[model samples]
Target: MAVETGAGARAGMEAPALEGGAVLGSLLDLKADALGTYLRARQRHGDVVRIHVGPPGLRMDMYCVFSAEGAQQVLASESANYRKDNPFYEEIRESFGNGLLTAQDADYLRQRRLVQPLFTRRRVDGYAGAVAEETAGTLASWARARDAIVDVSDEMMHLALRAVSRILFGADADATTDVVHRCFPVITEYVLRRGYSPLNVPRTWPTPGNRRAAAAAEELYGVCDRIIAERRAGGDPAEDLLTLLAGAQSPDGEGFDTAELRDQVLIFLLAGHETTATSLAFTLHLLGRHPEEQARAREEVVRVLGDRTPEAADLDRLPYLTRVLKEAMRLYPAAPVFGRNAVAAGEIDGYAVPAGATVVLAPWVTHRHPRYWSDPDRFDPGRFTPEAEASRPRYAWFPFGGGPRACIGQHFSMLESVIALAMLLRAYEIEAVDTEVPLSAGMTLRAEGPMRCRIRPVRR
Candidate 1:
């Protein structure tokens, strides 16, 4: 989708356009190879490229903006000029209905405000014990297979699920976690595939993917409903996000209706676990490949906590691990591409943009732009040191995204990641099984196969 309109370049007033019939060819490239397609587009077409995407019979031209300046324009400076009207957001609502993610403007603000209190400093601090416990539990499992090659991706996914399940529901999630871990990905992958696919099939058509997604959703929703039902019946007697949510009143004073509560819970389950899992897997893979950084992080763990389990306060003390995680996210962001439909005709970074055109903001592309980082592909955590970070543009390295509509769970994600990574590194020495893991782009950036690593328990 690299657009090189030499004719338009001479005119100066017009944005470059993709040549004739290249749209279909570009569509094939995007579907078959997302990371390569975007990376190549940036290489060939500069930061701003025009491409067409949609079904075989129907297509809509969209701008793929790669520059940090363009990213700022769409996500921050003129954010109001854009809205979540894309197929991607609509499809997410299939499983995560009207949660903060798919909700727009006033509705999004309202929900964010309602849920914001759940992550207040004291409340967030309280979840540390549970997070550490789950980390220990996962480590226990890993210990049984010491020195064996393990799939870091699989282990991290389950660890994240168990931890988020406890934090979200505020109690034992053994049964619920099994159900969610079993079925949530089924629905999410289907929605993601449909949202990005060229042929837009209506979910009402009952195709195989749709049927599996629907069945998985029903089972997932039932688990949610059961949790709500149990809490109402005085089950567990614990105060968690669910407890407050169960009694949470709307801005107008009505507690959320059953459907409303369901939406919020479903979003937490999917967003809370899946994204963190992916990030952790990438973190481990990076650490496995970079042994020196791994050793430094391990040294910090020893100096800070010795043999004790990492507590909430221990997170801030491990600055280097934080940097390592941040750098991994820079290279392999969980949600690689985010789009907003233009609410009105506008110009972005000198390009004419029409109303309703999808403006794509890709961390996958911007995070690697040479102007923003020296040797952008290098795995250097020093890039995130305080002085180094302040030297860079704010929007240049957004893994969780930016502005008023930024990810609400970012604080929770960082805290959880710090805890999980610290605990894992403190316990094991990670050796890379392969020189590098192949990358793929989806709803999340993923390793195309198991990110295999050999783990040895720390002798100390």
Candidate 2:
């Protein structure tokens, strides 16, 4: 479709085509309204669409594959060829350095191997008591503030951050929470803005926002560094992630240096909490909107553990709650869009993808694909039931991604979500105050405004 340009045209050039050029431009503008444009293109142009967006000579391709087979191909089968290389990583790498999330090739593999054990099911299960205690405490506070509108997004972030800090560092830096909280918003704003803008500015340049973000990054690093130094000086051998890493020795009997330790800590603090917090927030939003499912989940939780706190063993009994989280992730994946740069020439479902081209596989698109889902847009947790789930293909629902580079924190996040949801539902009945709020995409998919809800104590 041809659309008129809002601005005056240049002397020698005609207006950019709306179907491709103008649509691409809107994405670069980072306007929330551009979502419909992208969705319409997906509907009209099939799975893969090409547009010229980035710097000259670099053509970006956007893939909206809604098939299980296609998702598997991109994430699992040919994953090695697809490493993270995009504007998102470019901005993150500035502050985070090449930690596991941003590392590639041998560096990535080595780091992932070293850090993988800390997030194992066995290790994560050990933290269940800590998770439950923190969650119950948070819920008690929420209950005290009866009938007040709460930003579930912020609440979840705080809860997740606390759990992560307790498990990872074995310390509760409540006094430092204010400083850490202030730092993230600055980083998030700068990264999101830079991801979309066309203006290329050096980070060292004296931009007010850039300076603030840099200072925040430095402050965050300083806090982590001090903690590490103190732990080293005290020389207490604990099973926490930080201590585990400190004592960890490779086959060659080597351990991470100060710089490497700082990088890993920063990556964990950012990736570990924010992603889980977003998932939990969206899950709660879904539960509020779907009262029937929420009730079913609560019943399941109550039946499993009458009045006691949930333990690691109780996780398997709460099948309904597990399905609920799985379904929520499908609708609003924390890391909705993932990209990879092609290392060599490849073909994705018969399309000739050239070498060095960027390939994107969006769970946001695939999870709701009409071909795989019965009613793609509906909130149906039952779809994740064992029989129903078995009927679907392997990669049909990958909220935590797939294959080697899949999120190492998947087990930890799932355990945390289950515990948090069970504890919260056990205490309160939640209902959405406004169900019409639009879903906005950010660092993670979140509601544009606070997900206001009414929480009443559930009568035993």
Candidate 3:
């Protein structure tokens, strides 16, 4: 059925469309190269594009909204009409549990209430010590490398995982960090494959993907469950995130049950580390690719702190470094694309959208929209300057998304990125050895190939 258009706007339009090509080809593109496919659609079909996938009887219609205004409507102004009922979210909730990221309605409200205080600006700022300690450890390991050529991506991943792990688990972090690092890829890959599959079989079936995902989920959940049990057994309580959750209660004095606790931990591990890791990795890689920007950022870092590590207070002082990180997020948002199910028919950018249609909001495309960004492909941190940013629509750069359902850990992610970047840049001079990073859009953005950079000790 054709989507009905608004009477006065873009009359008779059902959203511009891209040729779906062969059914098999469309399915393959959606599964394997969703980012590239979305980019092609946006470039060809303006902001509100209609995509038809699958055969006539079983087709799925995806309304791809790329304009900043359209994104605002879908994500913020009219967010209630868009819900986390899409197939992608279903796949995630199945594997990762109905935690904050995937929860809806009553569950979502309760989770948000219980978890909100833990991520507040004051509370998150208190975790800066963990960020600094982990960053210092990373720099020390880099100093040991004989050739000083490092996989910046891998290094940042480990550093971020360790940092957030410490903040979450405290003393038990040492044991959990390696397990999470090993299992997350397996689980996220499973989520990605199943999330995009047009037909998903039962997990009870012994398919290779299902078996791997099951094993990963088992190990991942087992670790969190064990840690939560230990914490709940009335041991010496530390000031970690896990402890906070263990003690957190709603107004009625209700707290998360064992299963709920595990779910929350799983989500924190996924969002807390993965998103920040992507941001840090890309920030460092972008710095490597742009030496002038790197040098300027390094100079600011040095001027701010000659030899001391950065704390939460230093974040505001490091303006140039913050811009660099923001620009990197603009180019490579960790959660590159997310989906919502339209609760009712609505017009987006003067194009009518039907109820129950899948809506895809792509930061990968919107961040590069030509109308909002001048020469969108360039690596220009200046685009994020206060004056320049104030000139654009609020949703023009929503790497962390917008509205009430926005990332709960946005403050924490920024704090981790700014600290990690400042500490690393102060210690090393980076140059891209493998400049072009082939990317894949998984649960988060991933560099499909190695992003290696050669680094030298910065002379005082």
Q: Give the TM-score comparing model 2 with the true structure, all chains together.
A: 0.91
Shift in Å, residue 37, candidate 1: 1.0
Could you arrange the candidates by lDDT from highest to lowest? 3, 1, 2
How do the residues 215-258 of candidate 2 rate in per-residue lDDT, one tens digit apiece?
99888888888878867786656667888876656777767777
In angstroms, the error of model 3 at 396 is 0.7
Candidates in order have lDDT scores of 0.82, 0.75, 0.89
Worst 10 residues of 1 by lDDT: 6-15
RMSD of each: 3.6, 6.5, 2.9
What lDDT tens digits, residue by residue, belong to model 1 across residues 1-460?
Answer: 7776633443334445544254474677677777777777788877777776654557777688888888888888999998888888888886678887788877777787788877676778778888889999988898787557789898988998988888778655876888887797788788788887667678878889878988888888888888888877776678878878777766788566678788988888878887899889888988999889999998998899887877778778989989999999998899888788998988876678888888888899899999898898999999999999999888889887787778878878888899889889988889879667777777777777778899988887
TM-score of 1: 0.93
Query: Model 1 misses residue 57 by how many Å?
Result: 5.5
| Residue-level lDDT for 302 in candidate 1 | 84
Residue pairs with colliding backbones in model 3 are: none
Q: What is the TM-score of each candidate against the true structure?
A: 0.93, 0.91, 0.97
Best-to-worst TM-score order: 3, 1, 2
Greater lDDT among 1 and 3 belongs to 3
